[model samples]
Target chain A: METTALLRQLSEAVGPPGYEAPVAELIERLWRPYVDELRRDPLGNLIARRRGSGAEPRPVLLLAAHMDEIALLVSGYAEAYGHGYLRIEPIGGIDRRVLLGQRVWVHPRDGEPLPGLIATPPPHILSQSERKKVPPWDHLFIDPGLPIEQLEARVRIGDPITFRADYLELKNRRVAGKAFDNRVSVAVVTLALAALLERTHAWDIVAVATVQEEVGLYGATTAAYGVAPTAAVALDGTFARQHDVGEDEAVALDGGPAIGVGPNFHPYLVDRLKEVAEHHEIAHQIEAIPRGSGTDAWAIQVSREGIPTALLSVPMRYMHQPVELLSLRDVERAARLLTEFIADLRADERPVWEDEHGS
Target chain B: MDFELLHRLTTAFGPSGYEAAVRELIRKEVAPLVDEVEVTPLGTLIAHKKGSGPRLLLAAHMDEIGVIVSYVEDKGFLRFAPLGGIFPLYAIAQRVRFANGVEGVVAVERRKDESKPPALSEMYIDIGAPSREASPIRVGEPAVFVGETVRVGERIIGKTMDDRIGCYLLIDFLRRLRTSRFDLYVAFTSQEETTLSGARTAAFGIEPDMAVAVDVTLTGDTPKALPMAVELGKGPAIKVKDRGMVAHPRVRDAMVEAAEREGLPYQMEILTFGTTDAAAMQLARAGVPSGCLSIPCRHVHSPGEMVDVNDVERAVALLLALVA
Candidate 1:
């Protein structure tokens, strides 16, 4: 698939934290032919294992990217206009400011996907202090653009809703859409797997489209435990260059992927990946995560006994909001860097796992 | 009732992202009873018992809401961020102890007007260090409430009753369980107060047919509190919904059914603010039918968190009924 087309296809797929079947299915289809074995774990992590030609018990190198997106869901309703106006809360992390004037996808029970818009209460109707404050979730409601009675009948509490931001291929190959926070990471993993398929490596590669990562590093934690990989790398989106963000926190967009360095990342893995990025002249940034990276790498690093984990983050702009921006070059670069890193790995030359029991 | 065990668990130095001491205690307690036990990378303890039927995951986080040292000032006062859902209103004036045994008093950053409420960020921990050089605590270290469990007639009060109470129930259940119809996987999870990661991964690894998280729920029986139906001393709360999840219909029915079968008094939980390990468990894999058995707790996430012993015991019984 064309990178932009694939990006749009995955972004448009409605998969909240728990509701990831649509996204998982699309991943399964794209990932099936490239791997030796593929299956979905009990927690809905789509695990695709690309077998190696090495000796028996080939050590696994896992790459995880969460398929779930930050979206909203119906929480409850209050009666008004002879119908229940839907009160909603975010599924993952969403800035309330971005929700203003957003088109939303409401997955209602027993019907077609319903189109909804956040009701922007006019400024004239608001009190002085109320106008200054972005309304709390209690005060926010969605209008599905149906008749009051029909809206009430169509929607129910707990139904999943995603933002309806159409993916835009921007000038200079920058793309904008919702859920680039992770959907693009999946794209990178796909590109890496496709690249790996054309090469030979000694270590097994388990590309896991992990679930419920936006909620926490849930999917990565379990996949780490289940796969018990010798080493793992979580492909995720980091903060892209923005004037408001601190220099220490931001990664330059189009600068390949960020090689993570921090407590969460194994120093050995970090050095190895950094060396490879340098060797290949792959544009990369160094991201410091002194504590938990708030990515799957944090959870995966601490999974049963510990898997030496590294984080490769694509720089993204306007994260957690609709229309998150990304550069396709960074995605392709991360894929190539990871593929080359795996290709360079000798099955016997493992990550620093001897001290897994300690810190 | 093992008040001694409860006392130790409550007083143990275990905060989210740091659960070694708590895990050590739980390992020794349940190691003899469980068929297999292991610790996850995230520091959660998974103890399993074999059975012939479906896999059942029962989870209770061992982590408690605490604070992590974010920055240390020149005078040694530590600025901290909450490891979990902790309100600043209840935290001020409380004592906290770090993993390394350094104790500190929580003090709010001053406001020009004393009447205004301080946000959590506007709080600091004073360990009585004369200067930054004299301080024993380092930035990034975590500290939990310094309190001990006390039995006040039918009630027990302590810190972290929000989850240690649930852990106590699970531990007691593991020791008492004889034969079960389903395979049991009990995860003494970690980082729930912060990440809710332990239960989520444990559930996915076990691939349980159904899951239940045991935790503490807020009660409104206190004077002039919000109009919540859950009351302290009421039997286990069968969760219907919370901030994170709507219980699967079958899981909700199963709890109610078990409660009825055991003739145990149970409240229907509709928590407005807090979420539990069940919320993360339900999201694991394809999705497991999940619900919670909550012990009614008051002053939750505080040093004075209180739970009725009767409620705790009944919660155990209801869980047994579900298992059988």
Candidate 2:
């Protein structure tokens, strides 16, 4: 499948933090044909492994991209003037301002997805003070345009609600959708897996479509523990250039993919990846995550003793918003670069870091 | 009955997202009392007691507010960010524990003007690791206040007593309940301080008719606290409202009636800030009527939240009476 087609399907799929089954199934289908074995752990992390030809205890490389995205959970239902307005709390780190006036799809328990839009007060009705203060997420509700009984029949508490929109391909080679944050990475990983299947590497590879990365990197933590890989790479999205965002600070959308360096990133592993990128003449940038990268790399790096992990990020715009954007070229390059990097790893060249226990 | 269990549980180093130790401790405590106990995909320990009536969900979040190592500077000094709501004033000059069993002291930024309180961003934890590379502490590892529960007068003060006190109460109640009318599901939830992910999943899987969240509430006894109406040692506070979820009127009334019938002193807690699992539990099914039984606490969400041991016992008694 084409990367854009996969991106569209992955973006449209409903998989918030605790609910990742739908996306996991989708990922499994996409990855089933290219790998030797595929299994989902108890935490719903889709792990697909391809074996290497050599039997010499080669380094195991983990490639992770979170299948979950930021959405809303219907906390309570409010009926005003016979119309149902569902109260919602954010599932992940979503900007409250972007939520207002946007269309949403309410996935009720047993019925069709209901169409709704965030209810916003008109400027005429709002006082100056009300206008000045940014509305808290609790103050917003989804107007489903249905009566209380109709809504109650279809929608229940804990039903995952997502943005009701399609991916838009912009004129500047950017793609916009609700969950481009890690879905773009998902697309990149899928493409990388497809490329990897056509060749054999010295290292075994595990491509993981992890769940709950938006929440707290829960899926990656368990997956890393279960995989116990020698080396891992988390393919995720990072901040990209947007309007008013500084060009110097922001990674451009078409700037291939950014490799994270600094504290959270393993120094030698990052150096090796950069060397591979340079050798292959792939476009890449460097991101300095002085503290936590706030990605699955944080969890993967410290799982059991220590795993030398590197984070390869696709530059994405409007991160953590309803409509996150990514460049198609960057996604393709990230997958290609990772494929080349993995193919270059030798059996005897496994990088080691100082374990937490000082072994 | 098991003070050793409590000691281990309270001493275990865990913050909101980093709750493996507390989960393991609670798993051991409830292993015998529960027919089956399993940690959920979200790290919540769900201990089930099979019965013949409606399902009853009991929740106590094991996660507490702490700090995450943001950066380790060249001098082995570490900058931190509060994993949850931590008071900047209280964190200065306090001790903390990293996830890897490393100890550190929170250092406040030296300001030319000594009168000002340091911001959370300005605070750093200094563990004698010598250099940045030598420090076992890595970025993103959670560190909590290193303190032990101490009895002062009639109250117990410690780090993470906010909901651990509630966890202690749940363990006490489950151990004492010889017969239960409802199929009880007691969940020691994770990440309640940062997000409600654990409670959302636990409640969905349990699918209970009612949920009673045991947590801590701010008390009016604290000096200059916005009149919270709940007083410390005034028995368990039955929560009516919080920023997250309004208690179902029926559930709230049921607890009130139970307290009145048992002649247990109770207070109505209306929290202006922060929420509990009651929010997520209320919205779990088509709508489960959910309420909260909170132990009135002073200095909530801080390193040293104060709670009366009597209040903890009363909260357990109220839950036992209600579930019985």
Candidate 3:
């Protein structure tokens, strides 16, 4: 499958944290053909390994990308406007401002997922103060438009909910859809694995589609310890330049993936990535994460005896929302960079940490 | 109470993500004492003492609250974001030393209203550089409050004492502990001030039967302070509940029993706000029962956070008794 098509399918898949089966199944199917071994971990992380053409027990390069996206959990049932509604609480970092009037899916205990719409009172009916403010999460409810009896029977408390947004193609090879905050990076790992098939690499590749990263780095924490790769790189989304975001804090969408540097990222991996990007003429930006990257890289870095970890991010606008936008060119560039970096890794590679003076 | 060690730890620079220097100091201090020592990838220094019994993980964060340089203006004024809870009023006129040893003073942008104290967004660090190019500090650099640890009456006062004091308590406990029935894992965790990342991962790796976070907590004894039971200098505070966690009943009772058995003065803590490494440790895979032992602190999160030395000693004693 092409990058765009694969990402579209992955993005549209519903995989809220702890309940990532749908997306995990899709990934298992997509990765089975290319990988020599494919399986899911206890915590539901999808791991696929492609053997390298090196001596036995070749060094492993772990590529981590969380498959979970920001979603909602049905908290309770409420009735207003002569209709029954399901109240919600955020599963991750939901942008309350963009939540009103969104289409969503309510995953029930049985049967097909129920289609729902997020609704709030019309401005005319709301008090003067309410009109000027975004509705608090409690004030917003998912209108499945079912009667109280049916809504109560079908949707129980704590049922997982996900946003519903159509995949859109823009003028400049950009795509916008729901759950792209992560599916973009998952697609990057898939594409990279596909590209590495024709290349000669000394290091084995362990590509993981981690779960529960949106809630915390739960899957990455356990997966890294189980895999214990020689080194690792986490693929995630960074903020792209957009309104209200400063230039220093955001990267450009079409400019390519952002290679992260700072305390969380090992210096050697960062330098190697930059060198490879320059050599391959791959467009890339440098992202400085002062402390925590708030991604799987944070957990993977401290795994077991500490694996040297780096973060490569696809820049997207409007992250953690239904309509996250990104450039497909950037995704391809990120894949190429990863394939080249893995190809350049030596079987006997040893990590070198800079001294106190970083000399 | 090893005031010299407390002084050294409180003065060390180890903000949330940048814990290298502190980790090295601790690695050296505990290397000879423990059977094995390892610094986790995220910079947590975990020292293990072999035992045949159930594993007990004790976490004390080496990292402290600080600020990260977000943007450096052309005039050398650096805009920053707080790595942890930073009160603008507490920060103004304070000195901050960067990891590179470059010093800066905290100041606020002038506002027309002047009615309210400046928010962190309105605050900037003046590193005394004439231009951005001339400044030694760059964006993404971290800086902590520069304060001297000193003995004032019965109190140890300084910056980073909120956690370094906790580190000191753990170090003291490790030094004093002779033999234990429980396997001891002492973790000098990182990033507690920011994300509690260190404790969360350390507990997962160690998979301990139970854990306790040795850190400082607020006291209500101050004049006109919010009414609560904990008070400075009276005793070590045993956490019952905090904003982030309710101490696991088994662990909480164990601490109470240890304190009572040791005859060490202790207080039950119910903090209205704030949390510690114990909160994160308790949630680690399959759940590990966890609680916190707190040194009563006054003026928390300031350059001169004050902790009673007697309280520190008692907390260590209680911890040693628990492990025994």
Candidate 4:
């Protein structure tokens, strides 16, 4: 599948947290030919294990990107004027401020994902106090333009919903549309896995499209424990530099992947990823995460007695909202960095944190 | 099902960052019931009952929001940061208990004239030590709302009901199980009030096919409160959506189906504010379809939080039916 096209579909797919079957299935079909064996773990993690050329029991290098997206769900329904409207609640860390005017896809229980607008009452109908405040996000509702019974018959409560916007390719190789968090990194994982198929590496590679990272790196936790990789690299999106943000806190959009450094990351693994990025001349930034990366690295770092883990971040603008901005070049660089890191891994290598500040 | 257990669970000294006492209590009750148990470094207690392929993660958070000492004053007053979300208005004038059994009262800075409400920075915990050296609570020590689980008529009123009710329900669910149809992993998660982080690791390890959060949620049936559809004593709430997650359709339906099949009293929950472990559970590996069974409680996150005993019982029933 074309990377951009797959991203568009992945972005469009209505796989909310804990409900990533649709997106996982899509990735499975795309990755089936490249990987040796693929299985869905008990936690719904899509684990694609490719044994290394060296040996069957060789150390595993797991590359993970969460396949889930921040989304909405049907919380309650109301009917009036023979028309029914649905109230929604958010699935992940959402900027409720940005939810007021986005077109959305309401995944009904039995039909195709439907198109709707998150409609609100007119300013005239709302109270003065209500007008002054951003109405609580759970108070937001969707209007599917269907009558009461028709709407209820199709869209039941708890069905996952997502932003229904087309992925737009802008000038200068930039792309936008709900790329807010990890779908781009997921695409990067897909691209990297595709690129690795033609190459040989010493160690085994486990390319897992993890689930539920938006909630708290749960997919990576379970998948990492099950995969029991010797080393892991988590791919995620980071905040890009805005005009007001200090350069220290943000990365640039056109920059290559952001190589994360922090307590959650293994210093050695981070050093290796940075070395590979430098060796390959891939554009990248040194991102700092002093305490926690708030990524899958946090869980992967301590999985079942712990695994050495690193993070590759794509610089993204408007994170955790619809229509986030990032350059495709950044994604490609991240994928290349992952492929290079895996190829460079030596079977005899085992690195642990002796002291965070030391070698 | 014992009030004494609920009382002990509710009264256990644990804030978001300090959950040792709470975890120890839950471990004792849950150890004999499960085939395997593991405590993660982040302070989550996970008990597993292995069965079939599709895993089921049952979550109940152990930690509650409280004050953490940020500054110890010469006069022995303690300036603090809230470990989780603590409304300054509700927290002011409330007494708190530290993990080391020290007691204190949250006090707001006094102003010369009648003034607007103060911010958390203006407040201090008064622990009756004359100086910083004499004070038993030091910087970074956590203290929660003074432990008290009171039975006022038929309602259970106390602090930490926001999630101790959840912790209590998970234990009760484990003890009452007849047979496990799916592989069951019950996570007595920590730091849910802070980040929902512990459940993340436990869920990853358990990776159940479906999951449910047993937590307490806000009810709108109070006088002069926001008009919410949920009310105390209506029944256990099967979450539709909250700040963290939208319960998956199949899981939500299964909860509803279980309630209907068992003829259990239940309410459909659409929480406008606050979140639960379901938010973490739903996003755990490949995304196990997850939902929440909330015990409707009034005055959530307040010292005098209230939930009907019947609601707790029904929530246990609804969860049992969903997983079974």
Better of 2 and 4 by DockQ: 4
**lDDT for each residue of candidate 1 in A93-124, tens digit (9 for 90 to 100):** 88997777789889986788988888868999
Each model's Cα RMSD: 10.1, 12.1, 5.1, 13.8
| CA shift of A139, model 4, Å | 3.2
lDDT of 1 by residue, B1-324 (tens): 889999998888777756778888888999899899987645578999989899999999898878877667788888776777787888988899987788999998768878878887678899999887889986556788888789999999999787888889999998888768998899999778766777876776788999999999989899998889999887889889999999889988988998899899999989998798898888787888998888999988778999999998998888888888
User: What stretches of model 4 exceed 4 Å from their correct place?
Assistant: A124-129, A353-359, B1-324
How many residue pairs in model 3 have overlapping backbones?
Answer: 0
* Model 2 / residue A328 / CA error / Å: 12
State the lDDT at B253 in candidate 3: 95
Model 2, B1-324: lDDT tens digits are: 344555667778767756777877787788899899876545678999999999999999988888776567788888776767787888889998876788899988777877878887777888988897888876556788888877787788877777888889899988898877898899998667765656875787788999989998887776687877889888999998999989999889989988888898999989998899889878764778999999888887766778887888777778877877
**Candidate 3, residue B39: how far the Cα is off, in Å:** 2.1
Ranked candidates (DockQ, high to low): 3, 1, 4, 2
* Interface Cα RMSD of candidate 1: 5.9
Q: What is the TM-score of chain A alone in each candidate?
A: 0.95, 0.95, 0.97, 0.94
Per-residue CA lDDT of model 3 for B247-287, tens digit only, reads 99999999999999989999999999899999989988789
Clash tally for model 2: 0
lDDT of every model, 2 decimals: 0.84, 0.82, 0.88, 0.80
How do the residues A95-181 of candidate 3 rate in per-residue lDDT, one tens digit apiece?
Answer: 999988899999997889999999887888988988899988878899999987789989989899999999998888999999998
Kindly report which residue stretches of model 2 are placed more than 4 angstroms away from their true locations once superposed. A1-187, A199-235, A240-312, A315-359, B1-4, B111-116
Clashing pairs in 3: none
